[model samples]
Target: MTSTPISKISSGVSRRNFLRTGAIGGFLLATGSATAMLTGCAKSVPASDRLFLREQDVVVLTALIPIVLADALPTGEARAAAVTRTLAAIDGFVGNTSPAVMDQLYQLFDLLSLPPARVAAAGLWSDWPNASEKDLLAFLTRWQHSSVGLFRAGYAGLVKIITAGWYLLPESWPAIGYVAPVRVV
Candidate 1:
């Protein structure tokens, strides 16, 4: 009986290490493609509409606002109106932000707009429009609790923007019991 050398057969890499390496590699690859896609998509936004966010950014925000403000947003036509108002608020807020902040927001939105980046960063495999409320909630929860600073920052930013937008609306004032100050003529 010929005895095979154990050392020669073993690659010495543990399964955990292999998986970690693979995950990192996949993340890097996805980010690279997403960056390339964002660069190519820069011109896709119409000149008239290209203020702070592109069309894709709007789509992302539309899909996410409900998830972020689940309890706050009403159902039926009220919900539709609220969403529209919130989107306009977000657009205005973005427009008013400094150039540096806007650039960072653009980068974040660009990543969220990409499929691979969305899956890798948010654990969301379904397209935003197709994603269930449960799926969206889970993704938000994960990012909110994530140890990664970038993920935490993203969670904070989304929540802040969505909540601020919703609360700033006059329609929301009644619900929140905020009486507007009277203007002095």
Candidate 2:
């Protein structure tokens, strides 16, 4: 038995493929660990009447989280300015919301700057490759409403993903008051 040389390994696996597979593997591991952290996911947010998410939504959601938490938003004035430039970034996560979800989301925003559902929306906001600062803001505004419809339909699944990540990595919590409620007249 012998180990392959580094150059030989590179020849067999294209660097691009290697990176992609490694990312996917890490994703799966994180998802598994998050699920394990929750112990019983369905039991956590037991709003019995709420609609459930499709499997695809759940997968996209749980996976999006670590990356979101992992990416540090630029600090200080730069971040504050970015927030205004993107309409406070909530524009992306608050779109086409059901009246019910819209109202609830508004409340949630008032409370917390980045609730789990909005985190999923923020994930979608960055889906495009090399999205421009303007394009990024646009994406954040337009698609943020997606999960709102899902929420209005009674699927509170986003809550589970959020709490799962929070529990798995306590340190991932943001320094900002993303969850603090604001009073509107």
Candidate 3:
């Protein structure tokens, strides 16, 4: 079997190598900034319904919610309600965070929401709405075990945020054996 040349391997940027360089964020920021400028995303102000996450960001998070919360997420009819509640929770969590942290989350959301960044950074070729659950899971798994620290951190942050949203729902407590504490006057 023929092998790839060292020069070629070094010159060509694969997702792994690209992630290893720790420049994916910078690349995404630059591209996202340009896209934002052209598309008016830079001036996107959140509506009263949502504090920070925009509609596109909500779409991205909606796709992520089920996958990340899988078992903890209720099935059947309850699933929709749980997802809505979780979205609200996530919105509150992101909205109430420190400005710096909130800004970082916006950057992450922008990276995921942009088509080019989604494909290049996360290997998601389809838009968040059209992406298969399996594909999304693979992306999450890859980032979870990635050699790059940034990806690992991103994965951790995502999982933490998603789960926090899920657990914050009172209905989800039964699954995790958490009972709401009664307050005594």
lDDT of 2 by residue, 17-121 (tens): 567656754553344345434543323231232233323233333343333333343456654343233331223333433557654433333211222333343
Of candidates 3 and 1, the better by lDDT: 3
For model 3, what is the C-alpha lDDT against the true structure? 0.82
User: Candidate 1 lDDT, tens digit per residue, 28-92?
Assistant: 44574567466685333522554566787888888999888887888988897889789888877
User: For candidate 3, lDDT tens digit of each residue in 1-185?
Assistant: 99985645864656667655567556657887787667765655665699877887789889999999898777899898888889899889788889898877777777777787788778999999899999999999999987666678779888899899988888888987888899899
What does candidate 1 score in Cα RMSD to the true structure? 8.5
Indicate the TM-score of model 1.
Answer: 0.77
Clashing pairs in 3: none
Best by lDDT: 3
Candidate with better TM-score, 1 vs 2: 1
TM-scores, one per candidate: 0.77, 0.21, 0.83
User: Model 1, residue 50: displacement in angstroms?
Assistant: 6.1
C-alpha RMSD in Å of predicted model 3 compared with the true structure: 6.0
- With a 3 Å backbone cut-off (N, CA, C), the pairs that clash in candidate 1 are none
